[model samples]
Target: MSRAAEAAIAASYKALKEDFVSNLTGGEIGEINYVTAVAPVALVLWSALQTRQSFFKPYTPLSFAVDFLLNVCAILLATTLYSSTPIVLNILLLAPVAIIYALPRPPLSKKPKVPPPKTKDADAENPLPKKPFLTIYRGAMLVVTCLAILAVDFRIFPRRFAKVENWGTSLMDVGVGSFVFSAGVVAARPILKEQLAGKSTALSTRLYKSIRHSLPLLVLGFIRLYSVKGLDYAEHVTEYGVHWNFFFTLGFLPPFLALFQTAFAYIPSYAGLAILLGSVYQVALEFTTLKAYILTAPRTNLFSQNREGIFSFFGYLAIFLAGQSTGMFVLPRKLSSTATTGTEQRKRLVLTLGAWSGFWIALFMLTTNYKYGLALSVSRRLANLPYVLWISAFNSTQILCFCLVETFFFPGVYKATTAKEEKEAYELATSRVLEAYNRNGLFVFLVANLGTGIVNMTVKTLDVGSRGAMGILGVYGGLITALAVGLDLYGISIKM
Candidate 1:
């Protein structure tokens, strides 16, 4: 080939790469919300299916396959083939299917004998009631994240559902925010336990522990940076800045938050602290030059090159704090139950979560209202006030829904009277596949990232037809599922 022709080909490839992910404005709020609701819808279906003895009882391979289809493949289809479809329509379609499966079977002519409780007790030994909702919640986040990371590369994937260049909400935007919020919610327990216990560790000790826990993420961040640069891969520099990745954002958070542990111990209200920090950060953006600096600064130095990640750290911190507050607030109490008290406690827990969810949702609307309030736009890049509120609200609401579904549909999981029944109900209510994803989420994510990179490198994802894209996604998702489920069956959890 002529040298001129080779150079021209290279230049064309460069332009194609840039245009693939550039200058998006994101989708409408209603569309994003509708898509997000798919998780709960899938959950309802899974719950309904689990209750049926005639269906996949005793946890066979076929049962796991069905679980994967309902939880993972359904989501993939929703975000791709049905990306434009209304969520309500999907729910309407799924509701009757769930109801049919959920209908009670006619009882056996003779009642089966109740087995004696197992002598080696696990649930009995553990005092705290299991929180299945949190597990499902985390797994849902992972599923969406794994899907979006690769799906965005395909032409069939909705462009509006991709990350926005600046202001607006999208499915990917919600994915990123929910990821951080869920991380916060999970990390909250440890922080709360330390702070609320009135225990003091040496500053050096806390810092060391925090950094130790964060080192894996930092190393992973560096690896990603090196690989992307070395491979000359296509990238959106503005998404996380030239050198910054999400791993760095996650890695830096722990040690930074550790600096405030001593202060947080006496502060008493993590929720208030979150509000104050978020408000102050918003003020700085609106009233000062920080916003301009973040949005327009030239990539002249390390900080400038990574301004998005650096400046947005404060906002993410506020989000983490808010999650911590939520974790503390929702820590289940060992309430004595009666007809009245059981009903009251359940109502109170659901109501409080619902109220907080409503508060944040309303706050998001108010802050973004054009005529009534600050009229601020939501920006994941900026991690500004509306972004924080949207994330908190969405997650709070999702968590609430999960709890409600578990309460109403899968109540037997909690109400099992004996060890044998408890074990069976536990298996029924929980998905082994989702449990695998939850247990090895970070590892699964790493594997998915590698898979996405391999797929992109091997194929022109943009040119793939809907059928071709779906085929590729199915194979990709299958590999991920296989890895997760295999590890889970062997009882091997790879946590870093």
Candidate 2:
């Protein structure tokens, strides 16, 4: 590593170690934890931005190469250092490094004029209408019915009907329901149109914005699919599983969220209801034979088991609804001159409560599940209420952390730079970190899986002794981290 790069790495490690110590010692570290947690994401984002910006600069290739190398080294260092740490701590330490990279540079002195709001045309008809409470209740009930179907397959029905085969079938049913629900919302253009028209619409425009904003991701996904399928890169493909699925799943989330937003607009506390319902259902599922039946089912024929039913759909839909409902009330609005100060304060207060609720939900999942690794997988049957709650909680925490840091600490960071300027100086720095998350999140994850697979594949062939095996394992860690960073830098795009 270059001296500058080495210094940066050292500083990052110092910060992370200090933060970890503070946590261990029960120090009164407040925002410092938050700051550290956001660092890695910020770094990846900066790296991506840098790479994109370099396209216009003369030294684009060199910039990419340097950033890629730095990221690889950073990842290698992190993996080697934290391999022995607890999984939670390892996960937490990544945030600080990402945040430091995302920290803003000194601002330019010139301030831009704030633009005025556009006037709406008088003839424009509003698309969204106020709905009766029963409409929302019925919608929620439909979701509940779906959950009930899945529950039946999990042996919740009459004892004579109970069988292990029912579990697998239920999983498939739920998966199909999830896909269908996702499709249904994606097709609901008129509802989306109306939601966008209303000034006080409960739905978050940002989710819609992010979905539209991620067109590049879809293109990238197709390109990757072509590369793997057409070019026969399957032989050389290192990170297959982790990269592909996330792109497709994220593509589905926005429209699905929008539909939920519209559906729950009238329900005063839909998120709470969704959480309560989902958690109760999950607890019931856990206390019975549901766990053994669902987890041990054959992986190849997921639909053959009884667990492939509609309740899984309800559980996930509840999560989707929770995210949407939270977003409606939680996301902060960009300050506009027309909006009164009270409006902003009220919004902030709502967001604060929403954030706390999300945190508690996540904490509950971490404590309740003895099967920690099971939840990390992508099985729809495994994606019961607890899984939904946990993932939603984690996802919400990330969003909240990002928003808080950006709004309070990194205010005006995006506004200060044009896309072009950001691309030049900030691209590699930002993009590198975000590359970890972008369209290839699942693909990158698959790479990690492949790393584990490779280890398993070589176990018999290598025939190494215990000490040698340990050494090989250590090297594998470094290689995995390097490959992850390389893939992240090359394929990911950073969004501000």
Identify the leading candidate in terms of lDDT. Answer: 1
Report the Cα lDDT for residue 82, model 1.
86
Error of 1 at 375 (Å): 0.7
Candidate lDDT values, in order: 0.79, 0.39
- lDDT for model 2 comes to 0.39
Query: How does each model score on TM-score?
Result: 0.88, 0.43
Number of the top TM-score candidate: 1
Off by over 4 Å in 1: 1-24, 54-56, 92-95, 98-128, 192-202, 331-344, 414-424
Q: Hey, what RMSD does candidate 1 come out at?
A: 7.2
List CA RMSD, all candidates.
7.2, 17.9
Residue-level error in angstroms, candidate 2, position 194: 4.4
For model 1, where is the 10-residue window of minimal lDDT? 333-342
Backbone clash total, candidate 1: 0
Model 1 lDDT per residue over 361-452, tens place = 88888999989978888888889988888888888998998889877877665555555665666566777777788889999999999899
